[model samples]
Target: MQVHECVSFILLKDNQVLLEKRAQDKEYDPNLIAIPGGHMEHGETREQALFRELEEELDIVPTSYVYLCSLYHPTGELQLIHYYVITQWTGTIVSLEADEVAWHSLEANPLDIEADKVALAEYRRLSLSLIIL
Candidate 1:
């Protein structure tokens, strides 16, 4: 099976993380709350893909961020996701394909979210250390 590369951004503000409710029509994880991200395109670096995906999905450009870690999902197809913690960005977030976009507290239960539960757990565990002062 081919392993695909994807990128995700954890945009945090006021101790809360941003999440998007996937559109019901989405091929994967429809109507589930997840971090903003998408598959990486050919010839694009991880950062470039992150920027492009964020723009396409939310119309925002990250100004500052830090690489977090990568996680693998082996549901149907193998997927490797590169996660990042975005500290600063420019432009208002507009959910183009998602049904809704909102800021959720880190303490919010991740069980309700259908995608990347492990990554969420990891983020919560390392947020204090990963966050820039």
Candidate 2:
């Protein structure tokens, strides 16, 4: 089986999070709601892929973000996904690839992919810890 390296960003603003519905024709997770990101290109570091994907998908460049976690996912194919939390960014959002995009209540946890669910749990835990600190 072929494995791909991927990077995804969870964009947080106020009490909402940005999410997208994958393009209906996508090979994996078609029309599923998900965080924004794509596969890493050859020779790119995780952060590099993260920033590039942000720009490519949403036309935004992250000004502030942090690595959250990584997960191995098997959907249409195997994927090693790196997750990030983006707190700040520059540029207006213009969806370039997804079928739809929207801001949703963070507490709603609107997601479809199993890997995304696991990543979101980690995000919530970290956020609560930050608040408690």
Candidate 3:
């Protein structure tokens, strides 16, 4: 089986994180609420893909971000997902691809995808460790 790689980001600002409701007609996770991101194209590095995806999905360019972790999951399509926490960015955020988007409290656990939930837990762990350091 061929494994596909992708990147997802948690966009953070002022104690809130950006979340999106995927379009109901999307092929993968239709109507699910999760952080916004997309798959990598051929010949692109992870950061390149990240930047492109952020631009395409959110209409913003991330200026600051940190890699959180990667996860492997086998669904109909196998995936190796690289997750990141983006703390700073430029341009106003407007959802260009999702059905709807909003900012939610950082403490809220509202994500609907299992991979997203695991990625968020890893983000929270890293955030706490940073505060202690």
**The candidate that achieves the highest TM-score relative to the unseen native structure:** 2
Query: What TM-score goes with each of the models?
Result: 0.88, 0.94, 0.93
How large an RMSD does model 1 have?
2.0
lDDT tens per residue, model 3, 104-126: 98788589888988888777787
> How big is the positional error of residue 26 in model 3, measured in Å on the Cα after superposition?
0.8
Leading candidate by lDDT: 2
Q: List the residue pairs that clash in candidate 3.
A: none
TM-score, ranked from best to worst:
2, 3, 1
How well is each residue in 25-74 modelled by candidate 2, as lDDT tens digits?
Answer: 99888899998889999999999999899999999999988899999889
| Residue runs of model 3 more than 4 Å from their true location after superposition | 131-133
TM-score for predicted model 2 compared with the true structure = 0.94
Worst 10 residues of 1 by lDDT: 109-118
Ranking by lDDT: 2, 3, 1
